[model samples]
Target: MVVVGGGQAGLAAGYHLRRQGLDFAVLDADPAPGGSWQHMWDSLHLFSPPEHSSLPGRLMPVQPGETYPDAGHVVDYLSDYEKRYDLPVQHGTRVDAVRRDGDSLVVEADTGTWRARAVISATGRWSRPFLPAVPGRSVFTGRQLHTVNYRCPADFADQRVIVVGGGNSGAQIAADLALDGNVDVTWVTQRPPRFLADDIDGRALFDVANARRRALEDGRSDTGGVASLGDIVAVPPVRAARDAGLLYAKPMFARLTADGVRWVDGSQSGADAVIWCTGFRPALAHLVPLNLRGPRGHIPTDGTRALSEPRLHLLGYGDWTGPASATLIGVGRPARDAAREIAQLR
Candidate 1:
């Protein structure tokens, strides 16, 4: 079998696939594992803290007093996971498509093609950042970009900005800028997202996680139509954002004019930058032969019974277990379960 996307979920899945003796291969687009942890902007750290953010069979090194860690720290841990488990993941191999061809599943990438009896799709929603549609997106005169494109806050140290989205990333960016940035930034939201306590351990998804967990457990997919991170549960993003006094109205944007963003109130806000923390979408378009998924764009895989394809499974799906499913703390749970399922296929 082949696992696509080398992020956290993919790495965990690859580790388990090896344990199951399933003759599987992990296909990741990056030069090494570390997943999205490698892509996050600097100064970004895990809200789940070190204790909760650890991977399967791998313990994250202790950080001084800090509960959460930064992207660099996470990358280091992923490297260690590979070394400890000796996971055979093909680095820098991007999977362009996954389709079934009679007897086996064929994975196509610019580098090469891989055939397998089953395929595990781990490309998560966060792999791609979603920017909200605005009226004058092209009119913005200053630098306008998404959180995905952000590498660090140094650029915003002395500028005026507008941040969109009510997710954790938005909140964190606002807090960092307000405190450390050398500039003033305004954060806007289309809707208020919920946040979980920094204690539960994982990434985003708040109260809504409970609801999602119930849905998956019941084998009833649809995740209530894949709402925002806050819709899932109230997590650190909400708590931390409120604590920072940098919150704002939802759905208050009008459009982007050459000057800046036009607010719903007919006021103009000049922004040197705009950040979208709007969350992510699943990358399952390549899984052509799989007749899976519920009403929401999520695959229908419960704790077990990988029924998406004859030999297919999906891992690292957000909020599969409610708040914890997609978090670093929660990924191992599904990885363990999926490992057993893969064994059954053998």
Candidate 2:
């Protein structure tokens, strides 16, 4: 068996695979164990507390003076978890393709091919940042960047900026910039931003998801989960920004102008830079040779196992793969199930 990626999802899969006593290697494109967490913006924090944001066997150690663990802390936790488990992960091995070879699958990577009875793809989405196509986007002369390129608020100090998208990244980055005071920030969203209740966090959200899943499994009326509450979670910085009236959002602009943007109401605002907090698409380019992608650019799966190919399992893309499987705490159950299923095949 082979698991592609060494992020939280991949590491979770590794833990379960170890318990199954399976022979496997986790191939990570990165040189280290932290995965995508190490690449996030400096101020980024988990939506939940450390205990609720941990991987399979070990709990993430809480950082002093932090209600929510920041990106650096999460990186440390992942690195520690990898070492604690002694999972066989091959760092810096970038898998280029997965192809069927007789009764097994061949994983072709920079480090050479590995033949395995089953392959689990847990690459996640951080590598492929999505930026929507707006009119006159190319003509805008100011600096434009996506969430992946943003590092810290100090980078945009004393400049008029536009933050696009209504998701967590949009709110967080806008709040981060708003706290700087020197940066003139304007948040633009497709619709009015929906902020979840202040008391709600990832733990509550996870419970709601589980409840909804149970309801569906029992053939009862579908009780909604996080989406029913709202879109953005009121993290500390975001709540602070909201309290300070710095998190107000404007309707999305109709098009980009030479210096800034033009709104649907014929209003315009000049800006020095535009930051796109738009989300990401799964990084599944390596699976192209498998010819498994559907019209929606997703490989159809039953639970984590690929629908078209039993030897392939897709993990951590989103709720479609498993309930909240993209999150640290939410991935364990699905990873365990996938590992169990693979073991049965053996």
Candidate 3:
């Protein structure tokens, strides 16, 4: 067996695979552990408490004086988890493609090729940041960057900045900049931002998702999950900014101008930089050789198993693969199921 990532999803799969007593290798492109968490902005934090933000069989240690663990804490925990479990993860092995070789699957990586009875592609979306093709985006002369490139608020100090996107990333980055008191920040969204209640966090969100899943499984009326609550969770910093009236959002811009953006209302604001907090798509380019992608650019799946290729499992992409599977707390269940199913097949 082979897992094609070493992030939270891959680690979770490794844990369960170990329990199943399966021989497997987790191939990670990164030279070290921590996966994509190491690339997040400095102030980025999990929306859940440490306990709720843990992987399977291991609780993330509590960070003293923190309500939510920061990205650095998560990176450290993942590093330790790898060592603790002694999972067979080959770091720095970049998987280039996956294709059929006889009855088994061939994983072709920069390191080498490996044939396995089953392949679990847990490569999450952080690698493929989504940038919408807004008009005049190519002509914008000012510094423009995606969330993947952003590091800290200090990098944009004293600059007139605009943040695009209404998701958690946009809210968090805008709040971080507003708290800095040095950057002139404007936040714009396609629609009004929807924030969850102060009491609701990732734990509540996961419960809601589970409830919805149960309802669907029982053939009852579909109960909505987090979307029914709101798009963004009111994390500490975001709530603070909201309370202080520093997180107001304008309508998305009509287009990018040379110096800044022209709003939908025909008003223009000049900005020295624009940070796109746009989300990401699944990083599944390596599976193209399998020729299983649907018209929507997603592989059809029954749970995590690819519909066309039963030997391939796609984990931790999104709700389509498993409910909230992209999140740290939500990924374990699907990962466990995938490992078990693979074991059964063997």
| lDDT score, candidate 2, position 107 | 96
Please provide the root mean square deviation of candidate 1 (C-alpha atoms, Å): 4.0
Q: What tens digits encode model 2's per-residue C-alpha lDDT throughout 1-346?
A: 9999999999999999999999999999999889999999988999899999999999999899998999999999999999999999999999999999998999999999999999999999999999899999999999999999999878988899999989999999999999889899999999899999999999999999899878887999988767899999999999999999999999899999999999899988899999999999999999998899985678889899999999888899998889889999999999999999999987
- What 10-residue stretch in candidate 3 is worst by lDDT? 293-302
Per-model TM values vs. the true structure: 0.84, 0.98, 0.98
Deviating ranges (above 4 Å) for candidate 3: none
lDDT comparing candidate 2 with the true structure: 0.94
Where in model 2 is the C-alpha error above 4 Å? Answer: none
How many pairs of residues collide in model 3?
0
Deviation from native of the Cα of residue 314 in model 1, angstroms: 0.9
Residue-level lDDT for 16 in candidate 2: 99
lDDT of candidate 3 over 117-167, digit per residue (tens): 999999999999999999989989999999999998899978999999999
Candidate 1 weakest lDDT stretch, 10 residues: 225-234
